[model samples]
Target: MSSELPAFSWPTDPSLQPAIAPVPTERITPEWAWGGSTGLGMKVCIVDSGVDGDHRAIGGMLRGGAVVEETDDGVEVTEGTHSDLFGHGTACAGIIHSIAPDAEIYSARVLGKNLKGYGSTFVAGLQWALDNGMNVINVSMSTSKQDFAGILREVADQAYFSNRIIVAAANNTAVYSYPWLFSSVISVACHAEPDPFTFYYNPDPPVEFTAPGVDVDMAWAGGKRATGTGNSFAAPHIAGIIALILAKHPTLTPFQIKSVMYYTAKNVRTELAAAEEEKRDE
Candidate 1:
């Protein structure tokens, strides 16, 4: 049996900027709602520059994965000795391991030594994750090109309906990006704060959660480490937590996962505080 693709938004009308918000209806939360779980056995795929499976920080944790190598024929995905070309993938994997130590980490290497890749490679990596049965995918990279937007959106929606979660990072700049902006995925950007466990759900659209991605220390290539900042780093933190959520619940749909994230965010109490103040006045 095959699954049907979810809805798509081409947005060629040019009537609005960044597309006029997704109307899923607004539902607010009063407090944190996630529980404790070790994230054991959850299949978490880091779809980035690939994971340095040999990195000490990841030590004996990788379940399995593949690397998208370029060939004259086109793109070839090879499954062996894949290590982080740059420090990005390892850093993301380290963050996830720190948060969810027991979650089985996998790598779908798409980026290269330059830490950048074309849209086709990005899409290919994601499709590999979906096909390989990854429960949660961490995509710290996105293609800003308008050409690949529709296809990426379709894939993201497919992941959503298929019970797979794709946590994506918004672009570092204000430029437009796909997969992250698509409503099907959990789009994230960096906030000024430093708490890895702290996340804020935007009551607005395009971007959803805001987590730690500033001046953060993380694992790097060649068993080294570094401190950096970007929405890219923030994404893994969410993915790690999602692994924990799945560990305990094990059957949460994408919609339900979003609800858990929104309510569990640190700033979730603002509206509740307002509601309480209203009651106090009466």
Candidate 2:
């Protein structure tokens, strides 16, 4: 005679049901995620050198911006319009504009002409973005200094909790960096793939996604266009996608938006295809 086993109650049981229903995989397709979305009514901040609002590639999407400069007292964040000190910020803004043309772009100029700035200025720029109601902040720069890591992590966590999406670039070289290394922000790196829309999700930690960044042709300062390659460019591609996603679904939090990205990622698509094939065979 066999002994009767106790029933195992699943979480799906009515008495133990979760407050929120799980999203169906089929509903997380690209068409459902960002189709027909032009990023209208979304505010995206580019925290970099600066943004040239006059750039042809930007198409007058630049709304307003701020400049963060280190001073004797402390970091001074000046609010208003600013110009791109280097072409880097324009390149990032162009990538995002190309993908999400209608999204309002704001520049938080932290770096000067040398493409370098004090980590304090960088933190100030990011803080300004969060305090000013930016929906998505594209941070193509990171500080390798451990001195700023603690403060940077705090800002990153604040963004995560506030439903703000921060898309940060992984360091181009094998070096330690803050913000990007933090789990709170969406970290991106370059994939050799040239298609701007084609991105892959990595199961690995730290770097969660890869986008087209190799030899990417983007807008430059002085109203010119140029080709550049770096993880910096990759961050904007993901930021652009986030803008589009938010435009379509404005209420999605940072966590839910990341889930949407994971579900729509190329690797996930491959898995979906294999599952469909297996089902057909069965």
Candidate 3:
């Protein structure tokens, strides 16, 4: 007797067409278990000071992006200028690239040209990201304007429904900021972790995630690098991780991605355990 079993084959019929079955979304699990995905083919918009694509830390590559400008009439969108006005944008870009090296980074300059014309420029940059079909947007800057908060909330929600993940940095101080404080966007703050990839999830409101932001060595403009600390650096770490997740699992919705970030965080279990302990004591 043969030890091997014969495989079953489908019957061939000239009169019948082959039917393909579609897999259900809920039943599918992403391949993030294996852990080898770059942000290749993903468009990540850095809506801050522009990025210098030639920076060594960025690997001398970037997707061509638009620069928002303010004129006497109104905000205008222009192309062919992706140079970082200040070094802040470059620093953020370097962190994102360090994690998702192949992600298609784009610059949407909205700040630091003079900081005087930020309102319109900020709106224009975000609008550009939405209009251009960005997969992920990293917003390291936020406005404290309460009057514009409602509109910004709507904008963030629109991106959420569109599957465009926006990772925003919480305000360093106790003062409020738009977009980041909104429930739709992922809000990140600082932690003491020295590893660039290390991140934690907070159970608190407003600040949902904490990544390495204390005295981090980052890339700056003019092909230079520096050590800095703030919630600004923390936002990009989550953004980069998101880029990796989106690369491996492009089908994941914004909600699903947020869940992944929360559950896979290094400190989630610890945080939950501590909360449970406190509740038991109470």
RMSD of each: 8.3, 5.8, 10.5
For all candidates in order, the CA lDDT equals 0.85, 0.94, 0.83
Worst 10 residues of 1 by lDDT: 25-34
Estimate candidate 1's alpha-carbon lDDT, on a 0 to 1 scale: 0.85
lDDT per residue for candidate 1 within 1-282, as digits (tens), equals 635445674445577435433324234332223355768879899999878878878866987888886678887888765778898999999999998888999999999999978788788888989999999999999887888998899899999999999999999998778889888899999887877788898878779999999999899988999999999999999999888888877767899889878766777756656777999999
TM-score of each: 0.85, 0.92, 0.83
Winner by lDDT between candidate 3 and candidate 1 = 1
Give lDDT tens digits, candidate 3, residues 198-270: 7887887879999999999999888999999999999999999899888887887888787777666777645
lDDT score of residue 78 within candidate 1 = 81
Q: Could you arrange the candidates by TM-score from highest to lowest? A: 2, 1, 3
Identify the superior model by lDDT, candidate 1 or candidate 2: 2
Better candidate number, 1 or 2, judged by TM-score: 2
Candidate 2 residue lDDT tens string, 27-74: 899999999999999999999999999999999999999999999999
> Which regions of candidate 2 deviate over 4 angstroms?
1-22
Model 1, residue 90: what's the lDDT?
Answer: 94
After best superposition, candidate 1 residue 104: deviation in angstroms? 0.5
Model 2's TM-score against the true structure? 0.92
